[model samples]
Target: MPHTENHATHREVELLETLRAQGGSARTSHLADVLSVSEETIRRTVKVLAKTGMVQRVHGGVYLSNTEALDPVGSRLKIRTKAKGQIAAVAASMIPSGSCVFLDVGSTTAHVATGLRSHRDLKVVTNGIHAAQALVDNNDNQVFLAGGALYHVEDGTFGPETIEFVERFNIDVAVISIDGFDCETGFLLSSAAEAALARAVTQRARRVLVVTDVTKFGQSAPLIACKPRDVTAVLIDKLPDRIFHQKLIEWEIEVVVVPDSKTGKTR
Candidate 1:
């Protein structure tokens, strides 16, 4: 399907969601008014969405034709909507233009890629194809993918080459995901190769932000990819145990406790 950076397309998607939420039907003028966009833009979006079978054009409005098609990313997206969206939004806001970032693989990190779509002049290196696709979605960011074996389960690259490939870039911020986090044991990973790749990026970046949902807190994994001292900060849906928080402070690592619906800054 054709894509554009036009704000109208974004509005159209939002309009469709609004329509679905409001009994699956809405007038074009209402959508235009809600989006603060021109009526012409709404008409154009409606036409396109209608052709795609995403919406049906009625006499003076549109109705939902079909919900989004099911796909691999769908289920993971549903797992932590509020937390991931809030974390991604805040993380995306933290990125500066022209900054070089390293994004690791995971559903949460993919959301970070989504948040980064609007950024300009970014150098984003990633192991996840989905994350890399998201970084360059708007065609404004520079994206690089790690070369190696594909780990379908994680939807990313791995093996020795992927680890070595990541070591070459000097990243500004390394945004990584986690399988487990324990205040006493530090951060953990499910796969050794993923851990190796993450360790390389975390060590190389000027700063590191560990982004994960609350589910990772106190979780267990075999590989200890990093410790509190290895990262600049951790971003999560809520604070972990106090001992965990104390250990981070002792290591000079910042902790950012975010709500499931709100963005945040390090505290």
Candidate 2:
């Protein structure tokens, strides 16, 4: 469950769209006012985009880069941090006390790991180096990092040995995060190894929960992890438009649209 820039924030996405619309360049002040954030924050976000080759930062603002889309985890952590936090709180509620949970790698799942910081009597196993590290300190919660090949950029472990190692545990709930999921195609992801890891863990869990946000809807990826019908539940932020994805519920997959904790708004 390695994270990707696929979870980019609404502001970042809007900025990119605005840049594209403005013939590949825009003023930083204009963007800050449009996004209602400080100029410093906008500049910081631009610097990250510039470093990632997604944009070229000019004196006043940025221009779109010709480089291909790079969905790195770090960029994603900055994007949608709040929405993912809200989603995490809801997903964390599903795990009962003393449950054996399989936490996967992904920015959203990382939030879930953070949301669980106060919980006690939980056993956690994960392929994510970050997720494993986030859960290791609790006196009541035990953490295990499945051993295998380390994918540095994705911050995940994978391979046959890793899959075999994870299969040995009887997990109460498999908490997974994915990219590019659709009601028809189910779970699709950018990395084959991460998708393989997801499939392997879900195969052994008593229940499977796909924790994701609306950004994933209708996107495409090379690998299909699982179908909606196969998952036990899907925890998502309430998207403004869900009429087209109603079939997902018809598939018998429970859908939980989490509300923003601060605003108390589902949309």
TM-score of each: 0.68, 0.71
RMSD vs true structure, all candidates: 17.3, 11.5
Each model's backbone clash number: 0, 2
Residue 133 displacement in candidate 1 (angstroms):
1.3
lDDT of 2 by residue, 1-267 (tens): 223323334456556656645556779998888778899989987876666445788888787763111345555667788888888888888888788999887888888888888888888988887777777888589998888998665677888988988998889998888756655456766556777788777777889988887766665444567655568988888652565357676777788889878778777
User: What's the CA RMSD of model 1 in angstroms?
Assistant: 17.3
Give a tens-digit lDDT track for model 1, residues 1-267.
212211124455566646755566789898888878888888888887676445689887887753221123435767767788888888888888789999987778899889888889998988888888776647578899989998655778998899888888889999998766666557866456777787777878898998986666655444556656679888887777777778778888887776545233432
Task: After superposing candidate 2 on the true structure, give the runs of residues whose Cα lies further than 4 Å from its correct spot.
Answer: 1-70
